[model samples]
Target chain A: MTKQTPLALWRRPTFWPVALLALLWLLNAALTPNFARIEVRDGRLFGSLIDVIHRGAPVMLLAVGMTLVIAMRGIDLSVGSVMAMAGAVAAQLIAVHDAPLAVVVAVPLVVAAAAGLWNGLLVTLAGMQPIVATLILLVAGRGVAQLITGGQITTFERPAFQFLGTGALLGVPFTLWLVAGVTLLVGALLRLTPLGLYVESIGGNERAARLAGVRVRAIKVAGYVLTGLCAGLAGLIATADIKAADVSNCGLYIELDAILAVVLGGTSLSGGRARMVGALAGALIMQTLTTTMLMRGIGQEYALVIKAVVALLVCLIYTPRFRGALQRLVGREVHAA
Target chain B: MSLLRRNIPLLASVAVYAALYVGASLAYHHFCSLRVLINLFEENAPLGLTAVGMTFVILAGGIDLSVGSVMALCSIVIAVLIEQHGWHPLAALALALGLSTLLGTGMGCIIHYLQIAPFIVTLAGMFFARGLALIISVEPVPIRAAGHAWLGGLGIPLTGQLDIPITALVFLGALFVAAYVTVLTPIGRSVYALGGDEEAALLMGLRIGRTKVFVYTVSGFCSGLAGVLFTLYQSAGNPSAGVGMELDAIAAVVVGGTLLTGGVGGVCGTLIGVLIFGTIQTAIIFDGRLSSWWTRVAIGTLLLLFVLLQRALTSATGRRKAQHVSG
Candidate 1:
């Protein structure tokens, strides 16, 4: 890695994601009145920016996990379904019987981890392709969750359980703090440990990584488990916020959002690099864009269209060919002038 | 044993489809009837057509996740033109199919030209199509024109109690064309070559870019046709129509012994796959003990089994190839 100076850091590929987030913030500020305002309403922070961070917390958690997974040249498309399953498990525990709060939270996380282990096993032992292996869960996980909930959206009234979603810390939503904590922890773990280097080597070339004695299978499985844990936490937050488990709609198409956020963070989906902060910034951009669209009274359908355009634009910008073409175009213009 | 090992995937698919049909027939009296058989094809015609397209894209070592959304977009466009804009049904359909093909070509361009992943491009395509469908009409629009209604009503009686819908015929027609293309055409061989090994195919001087774009366009056309079939079946164009349909198409292709990694499947297998899917759905309905959600679970389980089977087959063959080389 190159020596990190302020200028070097700003010129890094990861910096683009943060810059994109800042640009979105500026756009939001311009388009929406008082977008930057933070008021102490009932001792709670209330503003669009705070709301973006709060609403973005779940995706940020997912992106944090997703960044690592994608860095290993693998993807977990089942994360959304896993989220639904986790949320369903939590809601079922709370709504059906008087389960202990600890059990409610622990059971889902454990189950999610187990689900991730299954994905890891399929990929590692069965030697199945990652996309196909995870796809099985993607299709069936929601069905299993529905089975657990008996096809009903189970609602829970436990205030303690709800606190995980709606509670605040120092006038900020508890979810924001949870996201920050998780991001920091995962970032620190990756940055400070040999695991990060192993992941990069494995993704860069699996055969070579194995030859290098990186214990590729174990590292890959661990990456998946970490993603599962993150997804479980996100699911818990979602369930607590709604006070219900919607097995069918909870985390619907969220895999797309998570994957998009990872890609937007300048992490190549083809793998070999991990950028946690960039992924967090990407998540914030998604949240801010959506919040801005909603605030502008744009319909959900239009917002989706805008999101598709943004996704395409971001993808194009990241492509070397597109960048080269743009540079050539500018060069020609300069010469003509 | 070698013969069995060589054809295990194809044989397995054929056996599973047979077993399911036989079991469903034995378990339910009505399921054995000709009317029910015809109804299966009619009900799943759209999925059958979409799977045909999916097979081409997958066989070319790429995926098209936008088929479901493209179908919905086609339905919405056709509905808006014929119902709201008072355009001719055929004209509306032509426009929709053309637009869908254009959309696919655009996605294909991004995939090949920019070298972005197919999944990402098609994912954006999915979002764009679905959003356009919703923007066109949030509410379901009933197509009430006489020509449209007549087209939707086209059904030919097969037996005293059995009738084949136009959509089923269309699906069969598409299936034949896809099968012919995959089995007998140079383009099809090129697709398989591309999927089997992209670098080798490029070195072999295959038109990788054209073939990739062509596959996506074919997928788009099939999706558009499936949309028409769906409109006929439902008699309305709903934006939410075909939600999760792409998964079903992918499932059908995989179950038909089409490797998700591509280059090892054909449309004949896809036909059986669609039939098997329909049979499962029908069995679930006939069982009355399980909810429809069980259908998804069943598909997922089948997909996993097939994927594992493929892995086993590939490894065995790989080992044999190595042995042969060494010997």
Candidate 2:
């Protein structure tokens, strides 16, 4: 009898999503003109390719943190609002304090981390469900953001900040590189450390994990804190991208998009599983699809409807119940074949 | 003690309301006046009505994230029918309600038959309704008819001191109906059972599907009613009306002591929740020193607190049950 290692088992689910994304990229390149161009001038990379990478960066950041959170059988609906709030706070600091670029950047991230800690405490100590606990933030975070900005768009005249969003590294956009770095860091943490095992065990069965002496509450809190930090990072990218902090529109509906990316990447919403590479692939696929639709002159409104439909279809395909129904519909002959 | 335990949400909600009132009164000189109180109720009437309807859905172990969008759709439909087609106000109101109910029934059917998650279904419903509203009209249309104003609260005098909003009266009336249905009806009991344990309720002969459909339908009807009330109070209808109001309704419902996981809650709790939510917003304004942004922060904090309390209580009970079984 041969025993399959855990690493070997993990390889199977991870490969397919990446392969699918690759196929999508190839298809888009073949179909769309100038789809894969990356050019460098004045030490800056620029193109539709880089734009897609930058635009998708925030969501990718979110997907990274969300993957961990969801791996623990929890969802963070407040990421969008947190992003908005962080952006609002970050922009406010820049506006009010004439703070240095680094300090301006650091303040919002800290605030976001605190917000995440608050969510963690609620979930761990208060024992609230993740969805409901995060929801309080989801509902109020935006309002806090608005209040921070005095219900106005806050703009900063910082070139370095804009560069984070728009600059390049070795002809690759800074945002893309950031995504790569974060993904690698998160990937390494999940694969190289005991943290991944602990998260998985805690998610798989909390009681068993507790009995095994796992600090479940601390780990859950850490997941939320990580999520908040990521959200704050995304907020920085978002604010830098537009060169302004627009509280009302920044990071709106991002939570849904991030969740979609995670789900499409083949991560189960029902915990005990984590897929870092799949999330990267999922984020790429989402960006590619959106870019393709928009470049093809698809109306933003219709694009939304299409995205929803595709998301639903993807969910149906991935969902066990829906897959089972599909298999039953196809009958035994197909299975036998 | 059992009664009190069963009604902790109600008690907590009342306590919050009282706290808000006292806080508001101390903060603002005119806050305790009847006129100010009436004004507050009038301002929040539509939201209160929606909260009442939401109580049913949440109690049934489901959520309607589309309520705000549905209200927007209903408002748009009513506005378009009255303003564009010259339909009478009452007829437009009925048609909007009917359409909203149909939408809710369709959502119910999809959830029950397709076995789709309520979260997904309602999220889609939100988009569909919001899209339909935008498609109906891109701009806000003022409802100028005297009859429309009457429906919204144009002519009623409250003790000859201030104009009474018909929306408030309508909201109160809806609350009464919701209270009766939730507390007095077998269907309501069935809803609680469904929330508690669907399979067990099914084995006990509850018509699970029908009960769910009924609650959703009622929810839709209330949303439509809320639309009419909102349009009347605002004296206009915008395609973007009621955006994010669903969160407020959910917040109110949860704060009112209705469990998000469902089973135990009532309209009375919801009434207090809405009032508390409204008071918080009013208090933010009254404080003058606080930013309106604190309204969300305050509500968010309170929501987290209540949800945490509920979680602790439920988990404690669950632990006790586990201990009982192990022992």
Candidate 3:
């Protein structure tokens, strides 16, 4: 093989997302005062940059699973609700049952996985569209969480549980470590096994894969179960960070963010291509955008507007029709010139 | 029998709605009162209007998540203008409705022209409308317009204790108009054709762009109308009002007997859906034991049941078609 060169890396599709993220980071550093300022306090790193990643941990975790799900041409809109449910389960277990940390964490993850399994069965067995299948949970999952928490924001304070949110293991945020570990573990699993290829094949063409003897149903269910696990962990992080599980508000609109991140990371909604690093960068880009606006003293109302504009711009840029129109317009000018 | 089989979903919704009303009438001593029955129409007037529009959009095989945001925006614009700017209620309503319809047209243009997903385009619309509304005023604004109150006051008296409000009358008028349009109008037929199969419709010389745009325009207008009527009904316009109304409308449409895949349901089913929705809320309120959140849970369960029933019906038809082909 030809010697790998830095210039050759530019051909990679993932390079653009990473480069965009870096450009955004640099812009934040230049514009927002003290944006690049980093501090070490109590042996833990702290700063706006750190804060963005720390806050973005939940989305980053979600992006990993969402990448896989979207690669399978399916979406899990219930991630936000699953987050709420998981958080509620954890909070109730801690506050009401006075469960240990292991039980507090384990039970919620299991519950979240069960919710994923429900979605999987609905889509695969019921043969319902993925959107319709997940829409059920999206609608009712929050109510179930409210039922569990008795329609109250359940708060629990256990030092170990809180550490998952607040504590540091090695002068860095625990959330960062958790995210990194999960990403690496998932990445390794995807790389070292045929699971990723099977997922891609399933997304590329289900009928063909089924004809080839792939267990499409089982694999699809596994993808959802994986997403559920990710959502569960994200929920635990959110709840632990606040020490309260706000049933209605804990993970509101997060699934939208994750979907946007996945899309931004260059995952096709039509299925078959997955990007891990790109999605991570996309989630980071969102966090950075929100932070940059906050630091610039922009009103909260403008944030959604900004997000809409960015999303629209990205959508336009990605559409082949729009691109063709742009090229024809430019080519016409060039011919005239 | 074939017709009935084809519309099993619709008939099922009616049966559920009727059963709920009958069950409530039995469970609660005064549930059958004219007041409660009229209140169902009154309370659900806005939702009914939006869901009716949503039915048309879903029928065309597209979804509009921006309805709630558009409603909130229109409501806010009307409130800000009529209350804060001393504009006439009718003038303010016209402006708000115009702006909302324009927003819908813009979204529809993008979705049609750019070939973007409806979810993404409407999501952008949702954020844009909600952001604009929030920027207008984060606080709730109560209408001080005398005309709003005057219209609110005009209602047909059935009993000494109750009268059908003008809001409900507006909804009923729209419902009749929509039903007539859906059944008789070429545009309505075009919408159904486009929804059932866009490729076939296009090949058959349907104006795909116009139909899609028209569907969104109607949805936008309906949502704006709903907001205006709701403002008159609630006497206030909250920027955050109808935060999740689109999902509720979608649920109502689905539960009322429409498929999300489009071209399989009607506005009448949507009305039954709204009535069912109102019945559940009112029944829970009367029961005193059920919590507010249970309304959502109950709706979800019903939605699931209806979906399964639809699935079974469709599969049965599928089997029949297969058997016919083999024979």
Candidate 4:
């Protein structure tokens, strides 16, 4: 592949989501004082923008995986529940079992991936619709998490976990680096291997993909597994940040936000063709919106309304019929002029 | 036998509901009386109404994640109008229902005209309604109007200690209307046709947009009614009420033997599903040893079972169709 110039990169489809993020930040800069200012405190950068990255990391990670699963024409509604379950599992290990940090982290992720395997198998083997199959876990996952914690919030005090949430590398937040590392790793796997192609093929036409000898079931299942892994990591970060795992509220409504990010990134809900960078920018946009709302002293409740409006606008802009109508209106104005 | 097999999901749910109720009644000795039956309907009125509405949406190959939030919004609106402001209870109810219907219409128009996915649009509607409700008030609002008391007092006494609630009557009435619409009305046929094949329905010159909007309107109206029933039953409206009720409603619909893929079920099945759901809750309550979380697990497991049942029926039909065409 030829290297893309900066202009060429901006011309690509991934540009709009980033452009929207930049526009949001610019609007915030006008509203709040020092909104764009990045200060170095204790050798770490501090600002609303940096704070956005830190707060946005979990969603960004979710979007990274969601972009792929959605590209495979499947959705994981259970991500929020999986986050609760993962957090519960990790917290139980840390607080009760007195496990090693690595073990605490690794075990939850494996469990989360197994949950994904269950969703995938339902879809592939039983021929359940992806939405229906995932909905089962979405409903039951939180209950399972609550059961794990004995119907109580589980709190843990692990220095290693806290450091994972707070520690920085060369003035950057650890979560930012974590998001970057996971994105890069997933990006490499998608780009280097046949996984990306297989996803697009199955999403575009499953029968055609099967006729072409693609491992449709395995690939589709792998997509969900990857998503679970990402959600698991997100769970770890969120739990570590709070130092507690509240099964009921951990990662609540996050799957919706992740899906919104994917849609804003210009990925069609009908599936096919994953947008990696677009999803990252979409996550940034959501975080920026939230941060800006807080800065403006707007109540947190209003953020939902604003986010919904913005997502609707993004969806409308992506709608072919809406675009055509806009074009016709513009064409009429040009002719009149 | 074929007919029984074809209606296997409905039969299975009925069987499950019956067995659970019977088993619990035998074990607890206080679960099978007329009082418990009346109480079950009263308690599950909100969920039952939501499930009926959800049935319409799902039968049209659409999903409405907004029902839960819409119900809360409706309850909040009525609470604020009746308590905070001086509006009459009946007037507030009408206004809330109208507002919710308008919200549903907007969502349906967006989904149909702008060609957005129903889930995405309704999810937005969910947040929109929830945020609006939160903006109104986060605190629980009690309905204390004189008229509300009168309405609440109008219950039919079955025995000295047992009576049927107005909420239960409203739910049953709504269920009757929904069953009629889905089974008898031409509009209902259009819904099934649209769900079965949108392209084919369009080719057949069905009023697709109107039917789509009508489905959502029914959903919105029912959810608003559910909220009103819930407020009456509980005597208060909490903004965060029914936070995850959409899932429960959907679970009930799917468990009732209605295919989530659409075009294969009715509201009557949903009634049985709701009974199963309520029975699970009642059983857990009676056992005293089981936690409430088991209800969620039971719901999930039952949903899986029905989905598998639906899957089997769909594949069998598909196979039969293939063989017929080939022969």
Candidate 5:
């Protein structure tokens, strides 16, 4: 491997996503007064920046799981719906019965893990496409969630359950800490373990990976199960934040956003590459975009438009052809001068 | 043996549809009526149109997640033009279809020029279309135009007390044209060849770019037609309409024997697939024992089965092809 110069490094594919995130933060700071202000409010950190991470915790966690799934040449459209299902299950347990804290948390997490396992089985053993296989749950999982809630937004009145969403630790939001911990853990796993190499080898070329004695099936399955677990935790946080489980709209389109985050993080949709910190940056960028749009009195509808444009621009920037074209255009201008 | 091998997917789809329809007819007395049968097409005309369009995209080795959103945008555009802008109904309809085609072509341009994956490209397209629709109108806009009412009311009386909706006829018309183009046209053949293998098609001197762009444009046109039919059926345009419709369209195409990996499906199969979907919904509704959500579960289950079945059939066919080559 060759050591790249600073200019080359800046021109590398991974640099743009991070730069774009920083640019968005700058934009937010410029537009909103006191956007970067941090103060201890009632023994907790409170500010727009803190709010971004706190709100973005669910997506950040999802991005961590999705990075692995995409790394293995697969996608899990079921994650968003799985979040709803998990939230619904937790909400039902707490609302219907004075269920113990462990039961409420454990049941949903297990159900979500099973959902992930179902997706993994469909993709591996059944020889189905990942998009279509997970799409089955993307469509039906919400119905299952609704059934669990009996077609109602089941609300629970448990302070213990609420703590997962609203509680703080050491002047920082608990959600933020959870997200940071998960991100680091996933990052370490990818960097320090052989699992990451196995995943990349499989995604890069499955036949070659199989020839090299990699357990392609197990790795693929683990990828989805991890994603499911992440989604389940995100769902619990979401339901706890609201104290209610709205199956239909809960976690709606979060999968698309997660995929977008992964893409913006310089991870190719074709797979075989993973980026942990980049995905976190991508998630924060998305949350900041949403927050900025809302702060500017932009309708949620227009926010979708802006996000779509940003995603398209990021995707276009990541394309090698587009980059080549751009560089050639700049080179032409420089030569003419 | 050769004929059996070739027509297995089509045969399988027909068999599935027949079984579901027959079973429903036997179980529910009212399900056997012609009105009930026609109602299936009427209720699902938009889905049928969208599915037909999807078959083209998928057959060309691409997927369009934006069809549902495109349909929604078309409906919104038509409603806004007619009611809010005071434009003629026919003119508004034309403009809506034109806009949809333009959107599709734009997406294709981005995909081809940037060499991006169709899934992510179309995902962005979906958001853009849906957002634009909501921006057009957050609430449902009722079509009070006399022309729209006429269009909506246009129907043919078949038997004693049964009238066929114009929208259903329009669906059938779209299906007919799709079948004709797919079977008899050079462009359609090019689409299939491209999907079968892009490099080979390029080697064979096919118009890869034109065929790719044309398929997406055709899909956009179908979505536009579906949107118009939806508006006519409901007499209003809701921005949120056609939610999850892309999935339904994809499901119909897959169930109809079209391969998701691309290059092996037809409009005829898609038509049957749409009918199977309608039949399932009808059966569940007639049963009344299960909630409507069960339709989603049932469709998901069927989608899974059909995808697995296609995999099996394709593998068998591939094996036979290999044997032939060796022999």
Candidate 6:
């Protein structure tokens, strides 16, 4: 009997998503004159590409974390709220205590990490479902953020803080580089080590994985902590981008976008497998779609409709059932005609 | 005792409701008066109606995150028709309901035929419906006609100092109908069956797709009815009126002891859930010192407590069964 190799296995499921992203990139570049122009002046990046990268940074960070969490057969709907909470804490510390720059930055990150640990504990120790556990934070964290901000926007003017979002290195936004480095680190941890294999096995079948002696609880907790850390980083980028902590709108509906990115990256929502490169490509495609629609002067309402329709179509194409039906229909047409 | 054991969630919900009423009465002496009770119902009638519909959907092992947006869309449609097209209010309401039901059917078809996940399908529906609402009217439309005022609280009456709001009566009627369907009808049993196990239900000769479509249609109808009531209450149709209302409905359902996983809940439980939720908001307001943020914190805490309790109950039952087998 013939044996299938790992290369062939990778080629089967991942090929379509990569090709789709490439096509989208080509379409965007062809439609817009300045879609790819990147320039640096006085150590700051300036370009439409940079704008897309900057806008995509927070979402990319969340999606990276989301990919791992989802691979463990769970989802975290509270990442957006976590981002909001982290931003609120950072802003509050700065506004109230006149905390040093380092303290202000580090405090929120610690809070976010703790929040992630809480989620992990509830799911792992208390045996609550992931969705229900995260739902608590999703509902309450925003209120906590609002409370900290006293229902008001907290604005700041600090160049050192803003540099995280606006600064550049080698003609790329600092946030973009940060995202790349983090993505590489996460990718290596999941790929070049045994962690990735363990995660996939657990997602494939939790009971079987447990029988095989995997520390399922530890891995799941680690995944959530990682997600929380990423949300912390995203919060920093978002707060810096606006230079104002608007708790009301910061990171709203972001969970949906991050989930879409993970799904578009060829990761199954039902869990098991994940792809870091695919997620990056997915992030790029989404940003490009949004930028293209804005550049075309489409109304926000219609733009949203278009995005929903496109997302539905992508999901349909990626799903195995739809692919099978399409292949069967093609075969029938060939036979009948 | 057996009945109570089987319906612990319902009993727990009622206990919470009674506690809320008592607490509210103690905090605000005026809250015990019939006038305040009527006012509370009037204020929350729209949400109560939507929650009833949400209850049905959740019981069927699915969710309708688009209800809020659907309500907004209905409100906009009715408002635009009456004000701009010079259509009769009643006719406009019917048309709005029909359109919303059609939208719900479309969603059900996509979920059933395409095998798309219900969450993603409803999320897309939420976006599409919200976008449609914005397309219809970016700003709120005030109802200037005198006749429309009756839609809010004019139709119903009560004894001196005990007036019933018209919206509340409408909500009560809808709740009655939902209760009848869920408790007495074969269709309701089929819905629960579908939720419990789709494959098993099919083997038992239940029409899974039809029941699902019907449930969503009912939910859409409730949302449409809620929109009309809201329009009457506020005396206007705001395109952004129902933002985040779906989350509230879901929260209420969960608190009322409905399993998010599905197959076990009733409209009565949902009513108690909605009352408890509304009471908490009112109590926080009555206390006067607590921040509005307390409402979120309270709901979140309640949700966690109930979820933990559910987990414990299930595990306890599991361990008992294991013991039975071992013995």
Q: Could you say which candidate leads in DockQ? A: 4
lDDT of 4 by residue, A87-114 (tens): 9999999999999988998999999999
TM-score of each: 0.97, 0.90, 0.96, 0.97, 0.96, 0.95
**Residue A188 lDDT (model 1):** 82
Residues B1-327 of candidate 4: C-alpha lDDT, one tens digit per residue:
267776888888888888888898899987888888988899999999999999999999999999999999999999899998999989988999999888888999999988999989998999889989998988889888889878876788887877788989999999999999898999999999888888899999999999899889889988999988988987878789999999999999999988887877889999999999999998898888887998998899889888988888879888988998999
The docking category that best describes candidate 4 is high
DockQ of each: 0.80, 0.46, 0.75, 0.85, 0.75, 0.69
For every model in order, the TM-score on chain A comes to 0.94, 0.92, 0.93, 0.94, 0.95, 0.92
The full ranking of all candidates by DockQ, starting with the best, is: 4, 1, 3, 5, 6, 2
Write down the lDDT of every candidate, Cα atoms only.
0.89, 0.83, 0.89, 0.90, 0.90, 0.83
Candidate 2 clashing pairs, residues 3+ apart or interchain: B153-B166
Candidate 6: residue A166 Cα off by (Å): 2.1
Using lDDT as the yardstick, the better of models 3 and 4 is 4
TM-score result, candidate 5: 0.96
lDDT of 5 by residue, A1-337 (tens): 9995566667665687788888888877887888888899899999989999999999999999999999888998988999999999999999898799999999999999999999999999987899999999998898888888888889889998899999999999999889988888877888899988988887889989999999999889999999999999999999999999988888998999999999889888888888777888888888998988777788889988888899998888878888899999989999999
lDDT of 3 at B172: 96
Residue B282 in candidate 5 has what lDDT?
Answer: 89
DockQ of 4: 0.85
Clashing pairs in 6: none
For candidate 2, write residues B107-201 as lDDT tens digits. Answer: 88777866666776677677777767876777888777777876665546768668666877888889998888887899988988999889999
**Against the true chain A, what TM-score does chain A of candidate 6 give?**
0.92
Better of 5 and 6 by TM-score: 5
Q: Write candidate 1's Cα lDDT for B1-327 as tens digits.
A: 275564577778899999999999999877897778888989999999999999999999999999999999999899999998999999998999899889888888889988999988898889899999999999989988899889987888776756688988999999998888888899989999888898899999999999999899999999999988988888878788898889889989989988788778788888888999999999999999998889879989999999999998889889988999999
Return the DockQ of model 1.
0.80
